[model samples]
Target: MVFFNLWSVLQWYLRPFIKWFLRKTTRLCELQRICYGDKPGAERSRNVEKSLMLSRTRDVKQVVSYLDNTVLERSFVPRNFPEILNPSVAIILRAKKINPKLHELFIVSFRRCLAQIWSYRLLLEEVEEMRKTHYDSSLPEHEEKLLKLWSLLVPNEDLESRVTKQWQYIGFQGDDPKTDFRGMGLLGLENLLFFASEYPQASSHVLSHSHHPKYGYTYAVVGINLTSMAYYLLKDGSAKTYMFNARQYLPNMNLFHKFYCYLFYEFDKMWIESKPENMMEFSIIFKKFENAIRNELADPASVFRINIEVDTI
Candidate 1:
């Protein structure tokens, strides 16, 4: 601990001098070094985010604040990218004493990183808002979505009544599934619906696994539990590596849903493979599972993809 503490203090003091020396020798600012040295995606984007946040220059710092303000201002519209980020990039270039005409690629790539970083922030707010909204039985839209989920997962059987025990067929705690969504809210429902809709066969396969008598578990209930896990991964920024490295180029609601699907699908697999004594072992296994995911996310190159083949309807 003492050795690490001393190293931290020493690095804090020498960081600026080291950056200055590197800049003098390479004739490149720290941002340029990261932007040019690293390949596109999470590693470059993550490093640029750190460099901007730690920068001493006011204009460089404004680049960070400007992107943030734009996100809060609801300016994540794709058409607004150049308008919102270009000025900030120009300001940063001037502050760093870089010739705009010479390093056009750096300006372009830096702007992309700014977009990726702030868009993820905006997406976090959007997801948290969705998670905070409690499921409402009286709301028609909410009711409709609930019904849609049932229809997607259990296609053959029709729900007899709104408050019937049929919900247990798909693994609700009681007659109604609304209360089960308390912690994750509608986000839980969204994740399940997306999985059933987008990758029907995969979800069906997992749903079938949930019914293994010796390995049986509540499907919808366990999905909500996985939803909580997905929220934590996003809330703490562990999802950034996967999000930024994704081919989507922007983190959005559907991407979040896909993330939740990945977790639910994978957790089902883990539960079966672990072959636990019973449901009492869920909490311990889930914690171990989450730790494994965190380790994977710590790698900047990590891009999570499930091996399931999407079955066509």
Candidate 2:
């Protein structure tokens, strides 16, 4: 009993020193990795680390604002933050010697902002690339995927051609579906394909909902509109809270796609619940939905996800 008491007393006394030592050692290792990692852009990443550290003395809000102005406004690419921030946080924690809790909050918030920036940049690149890639008849792969998507979503009906009036049933603007894709380009098509492929029953069910006699709506057109909504929310940083809270470190394409899925599902419910008079009221309804999303995202802890069961579909 005496030995146990002595050991416990020693442990209590030495715990803080042990923790400091561990932190120092880990920070050193992270520094080494940042400097010596085999990645292609080690130098550029190191430059970012230097820049971040140079501004470490700045208030959290100032740093966050700077990030918002700089990185968020830039073009997308696969980022080096995932590699850089691990050690950067350790170094910041050691160098700043701030209150542990405050230090943690700053680090976490900064990381979240960086993650949000990266996701936005990545998504922007994707959208831009898709916008530039016009649909071509020569690409068998693209044609096949489009056909497969149609088959998956509308299994009962056979599409006669790539261009058909049947496209209107799914919410295309006209007989030539490509015309509708002029704004969103291939990204709209890709989003639809993903929806149909990933959630076959849900996609079909939503299609059926689009055909309601009293309050029918265009599925594909509305989907493209929702894509624009998602893009705007992401671009304006309104979706940051949702993305940050939903993820531990960073958001990626899968997460973005999930957000799209959530929007698609929720928008359907909202439409049914509101029971608008006609398609002409779509703009009004959409504005209301956008406002609702913005309001929800005003909360720091908001996380958007598809919560409805698909088994019922």
Residue 194 alpha-carbon offset, candidate 1, angstroms: 1.2
Candidate number with greatest lDDT: 1
* Backbone clashes in model 2, listed as residue pairs: none
Residues 207-301 of candidate 1: C-alpha lDDT, one tens digit per residue: 88888989889999998988888888899888998889985568888888888888877888788999989999989888988988889999998
In angstroms, the error of model 2 at 55 is 4.7
Q: Candidate 1: minimum summed lDDT over ten consecutive residues — where?
A: 304-313
lDDT of each: 0.87, 0.66
Q: How close is candidate 2 to the true structure, as a TM-score?
A: 0.68
lDDT of 1 at 148: 94
Off by over 4 Å in 2: 1-83, 90-120
C-alpha TM-score for every candidate: 0.95, 0.68
Where is the poorest 10-residue window by lDDT in model 2?
38-47
